[model samples]
Target: MSERVMPGHTDGLITLGAADALWVDLTTDSAVPTASGAFTSSPAQARMGYVLLGGHAVATVRAGDGRWSVSEGEVRRAAAALNAVGMDRQDLVRIGPFRGAPRQECDEEAPLRWRRRITGELGGPERAARREVGRPYHLAGIDWRQILVEQTRDGTHRTWWLPRAVVRLLDAAEHAETQARDAGDRQTTNPEGPTATPRPYNKELEGQLYSVLSRKPGTSRRVAGWACAVCRGAPATVLDHCHEHGYVRAPLCQSCNTLERPDHLYSNDIRVANRYTRLFHTDTDDWLRHWHRCPGCRARTTLPLPHLAAWTAHIACRSLRPTHRAPRGRKPCGVLRVSWTGSQNAPRSGLLTVAVDCCPSGEHRVLAQVPYREAAERFRIWLAETAPALAAAAGPDPLDGLPAQSRPVIADTSGEGLALF
Candidate 1:
């Protein structure tokens, strides 16, 4: 078999395979001229500086010390060893270097980690205000290995993706910085220069509420039937709408859509909620609290909500695992595009948005914006009419079958008042 050279990198040798990349230590002369060691890869030390992870080698190189460099032949040996185990080179990107992050306090023993604190948008589903950090948080595509390249920076040096933890941590820090910069710019930008003052959202929402109530009462049918998508605990009492174009968005409670957030809703937040309250859910909440793996395809996703138990049983009866098999139907193939039209044609406080990339052939389609309350209520009515038998046939609540540890609960959002977003 002929060897394949990495494109644009003729000098670099690409190994055949590795189940996953491995981190190993070979030796090098330090520019500092301070350390010493000569053991031609000594016997596998039980408490040695490193050990084999799974079936590949991993060097435990501590920070801020020793000759942390290795030779080219040693590099080739490591690569060959990894290839022997089936790790692929195509899955790698040359990200950057492995320098310790700038720090003010001494945290010498601290392994790099990233904590993602979701500062949600105005009218978005508020997760438990969690800060999900990672040193491999089990999100898949994250079980990466660190490959520290030991090379002299004598003009022939290059950077690449830092092993595992630091790559994710660096991404997190950069994202936080970007968010900060954006917030600062928004706060300091000349309001009268180019940015027009946003129209007051609450006033318009109130006007829309009054108009809708004149026809019905309290809230729209969809909004009334489904719990607040944001908090997931309270009954939806308000219709989150687009302030500028007067288009309805989703069903949320006053607590979630509080006036402090004088801006639009978050797309992800609404999408997560819609994933539950819409036709089929793909998130862990309500009926399907934790995500599950598809036995057929191994692709993981959350089941639809408990309220949709009848429907879920219906889907399960069909035994459709589209990710792996054919004939079993999956999510309806279509697109929902919400259009923000001219002021004269705008509905009473709503959002005109569109969803794309839905069809099997990647087709795009447009859907009319309807009151979220109405949509939710329609499903509720249908479920009431036909869900009992289907749900009964489906057996007990799926939650009963799950281990207690796996159950996820909706967060409490009855706090006195936090900034809306």
Candidate 2:
């Protein structure tokens, strides 16, 4: 067979076959290094060094650091050796220089072993390895093999291969630094961010919520049957319970449930709360108890008195700072925007301005511009009954014509004073 020169071929180097790529170490000082003492062209004469076998070429020298990219077929053979011992090719990334006892099969006291080294401009692994100095950590894509000893006719001699070798891979330390920088950027941009991610609807957790609510005193099932306590439009799929106090609050739709999360309702911004609690018509005490962060005591419980009067009494605090200032930025997908348009101190002074922006055409419509408390309640009723989407969700208002005794056993007409949202 005639030999054809491969692209990017080096001068004075022979193109070795794929079968010889694994055994032959490509690292050498001479123009051509052989494994054996014989100068005749043979596979066994090739020098030993770290090899990167999985590339398309039969053998390609990357650098003078004794590294070679060998053929794919040879790489699989090396990978099979690792697989035979319950090791994976990916494991090479994490296992930094196999420090454990050498394979019992090998006769030599110290045989050529795999080692990990840093290469390229991927940053230093020194600092990343500091915390785990004694332990093994992951590097990106490289593995190395130290010098091999052979008993030759002349004498026992060590190959030109270095003991502690190098390769290139994704540095774990740099990855961590990148994550920290991203977190910092998020904090700087949105100071009022959520502390935790909202959990997805869980059926098992929902059953637990129902079990707990059944034992609780004031959780009446007749309040709003089958409809979400928040947005009466969607079906009540999530059973919302206060994670801190371990008390059941109300049944909420998946969308509305996320709004009631501590992370979403973190601030004292009433407008934000109002938008979330727009259609909430349940035991107001439960809502207040779950999320009312007292301005005076800085406590998040509705203790001493768990009613509307208690919330009004605990509104003012010496250390309280105004949270209703114009937001630094607007959310990308806010469906509802609420703002107080008049004096906030006076009882009936401000107009609870509410705008709906969740339209398909992106049209922002002012749904309500009414006074606080009583007017807000009326607006909620009007929206639920008249809006095409909400009217279907509200489902004819269960209390339309039921007998006074049968309709909603609990008389909760405290929707006005319960504007604590």
Per-candidate TM-score against the hidden true structure: 0.23, 0.21
Q: Against the unseen true structure, what C-alpha lDDT does each candidate score?
A: 0.28, 0.30
Candidate 1's C-alpha runs over 4 A off are: 1-107, 115-365, 382-421
Over 15-129, each residue of candidate 1 has an lDDT whose tens digit, in order, gives 3121122122211221111111111211222123332222122232223443232222333343343333323332222333323323222121221222111111111233222
Candidate 2 lDDT, 1-421, residue by residue in tens: 4334353433234334432332333322211121321111211112322222211011233336543333433333433422332222221112211223232321112211122222211124553564354332222112222212222224642112211111111111122222323344321212122112223222322213334566666443232234554444344444565432333455654445434421111112222333223323443333432332221111211221112221221221102211222377533333444444433234366454444445444545555554545443443354344343433333324333322321111221332212122
Q: How many clashes show up in model 2?
A: 9
Q: After superposition, how far is residue 418 of candidate 1 from its true place, in Å?
A: 14
TM-score of 1: 0.23
Model 1 worst lDDT run, 10 consecutive residues: 289-298
Error of 1 at 309 (Å): 20
Instruction: Return the top candidate by lDDT.
Output: 2
